[model samples]
Target: MGSRTILSSGTKTEQVFGYSRAVRAGDFIFVSGTTAMGPDGPVGEADIVAQSAECLRRIEEALAHFGAGLNTVVRTRVFVTDIDQWRRVGEAHSARFAEILPTTTIVGISALFDPRLLVEIEADAVLTTG
Candidate 1:
């Protein structure tokens, strides 16, 4: 089957590292690990909660480009630099996916590509065939 690339003017995607921000194969949209980095710059320099929200927000935007939304997400993976912020991160995540509640996994990580990054999230979604 053929695949499609999803991109938006609101964001800058990275592919030089041998990966895409998101790829659409048929009706499935696979999103790569999204950090809190925005078009302007990274968010929540020291706040994990805000960072987590930003990551999810970026993922939502990527999904939306492909006619998909957070509600269409079937799976999500979260990586955090600190485990102590799990509660706060979970709250932020729940607020975003409260209605859909996609299967999710959270892990405590030592660090990320950027030391300022407190959280990263990746998602998999199924777009409506309409």
Candidate 2:
């Protein structure tokens, strides 16, 4: 078994909410739901595709801490405030994982922590040791 490690994004809410942005246990890495949050608030408030890209960027950053990348991702769960915006979010998601083509699930929700956040994405990856 490999050692466990917690990755942080240095956000105050992590301590407040008592959670790490991602955790690597053994050969698996699990990333928390990431959004388009910025220093002040959410970014790309009205653009679903932009928000989705930001979420993936945050997830990628988290994964990189453990020597993993989106190509290593095996699964992803995407949450959105509106299902109608799936097309935009899907496009953004594909742009990042077109070659990787990981398994995914997208669901609609009533709201998120911040009203401005339209998309949230989480991912799971396995270390590709060679």
Candidate 3:
């Protein structure tokens, strides 16, 4: 089986703890947990909704790097620092994958790597090829 790594410009392997943001093995693309951090830095200080959107955007970009897109996502996992923000976060997520409607799970966590980080997301997708 052939394998490949995907990384956006300025995105480091160490950022994801020594792992590539996304790895492609055959037709499957496995994306690691993606935070709101952008190429310059994190987005949205304490806005869970904005942060959630940013996280999904980054994940989508990672998937695209591997010839995949949000529509190809098969499953997803989301983590939020506060349970009360579920509605806001969920709304943001839904807007991103509304068409794909991939299987998803959301969990409330005590905290994340950074206090300002309100959400994190991970996904699995399949690239379509003829």
Candidate 4:
């Protein structure tokens, strides 16, 4: 067993929901489902690719906080409101993890917490160096 740490994104939803954005236990890091919510509101507006990119970016930020990166990711889960828009969302996701190609799952849901959010992503990573 190694050190454990909690990482927060400082979003109201996190506090309201009583969950951290990510948790690091030993050499593994688990990131919560992330969306593209911005200062004004959900990002991407109506573009699934952009929204997906934002979600990945948020996940990367959380990983970086704990000295990890996308390369360390072992798995990812993506949830989308529309299955038909998978191509665009997959393109955005591929741009980030193309080289690493971590195990990934994409699913379609009826809705998200916010209607404006079309996609949410969660990731799990293991530190390889240690």
Candidate 5:
């Protein structure tokens, strides 16, 4: 087994929930379901597009902790509060992954931990080069 590295965003939720923001097991890194969680509250509140982008942004930040980037991603799972707004979320996803084209899935969910959160994204990445 490769060295295990745990990454933390140092958020209170992580401490309370007893989870790491991302975990690297060997060359594979798993980023937890991330949302637009801002210092004030859920960022972009009711805007799915903004929330979606923020979700990816947070995931990207987590990935960077392990010297990984979106291009290293192998798969992504998106959860949206409303399925009808999938196109808006897709735009954000495509903007980051147009070239890499990681396998992805988008699903509609009832609600998130916070009512203001509209989207959550989880990612799996493999370090290919270094």
Candidate 6:
């Protein structure tokens, strides 16, 4: 087995919650449920599209830490408070992953950790070597 690397987004909540924002084990990287929630408050507020975009941006940042990117991503799971807004969320997601075309699933949930947050995204990626 390859060595595991724990990656952080430098969020106080991560330490308090005792979880890494992302972790790499062997060639695979797993990104936890990422939100637009900031230290002060939510980034995109009640806008699903904005929140979705913000989530992808953070996920990309996390993937970059592992020398990977959206291209390396194989799958994604998106949780949203409103299933009706899936189209808006998909538009935001596709904007980042159009050519990469990673397998994705969007599920509607009752609520996130915060009521202001409209969306949360998780990703899995595998590093490609030459």
Cα-based TM-score, every candidate: 0.86, 0.94, 0.86, 0.95, 0.94, 0.93
Cα error, residue 80 of model 4, in Å, equals 0.3
Misplaced by over 4 Å in model 6 are none
Can you list the residue pairs that collide in candidate 6?
none
Full-model lDDT for every candidate: 0.83, 0.92, 0.82, 0.93, 0.92, 0.91
Choose the strongest candidate by lDDT: 4
Per-residue lDDT tens digits of candidate 3, residues 40-127?
5569767888888888888888887877789999899999889888899989988988888989999999988767788899999877
Between prediction 1 and prediction 5, the one with superior lDDT is 5
Which candidate has the top score in TM-score? Answer: 4
Locate the minimum summed-lDDT window of 10 residues in model 4: 39-48
Model 6 scores worst on lDDT over the 10 consecutive residues at 8-17
| Model 1: per-residue Cα lDDT at residue 122 | 94
Model 4 misplacement above 4 A: none
TM-score of 3: 0.86
Clash statistics: count for each candidate = 0, 0, 0, 0, 0, 0
* Steric clash pairs (candidate 3): none
The RMSD of every model to the true structure, in order and in angstroms, is 2.8, 1.5, 2.6, 1.3, 1.5, 1.6
Using lDDT as the measure, name the better of candidate 2 and candidate 3: 2
Residue 79, model 5: Cα distance from true site in angstroms: 0.5
Better of 4 and 5 by TM-score: 4
lDDT of 2 by residue, 34-101 (tens): 99999877777678898898899889989888998899999999999999999889999999999999
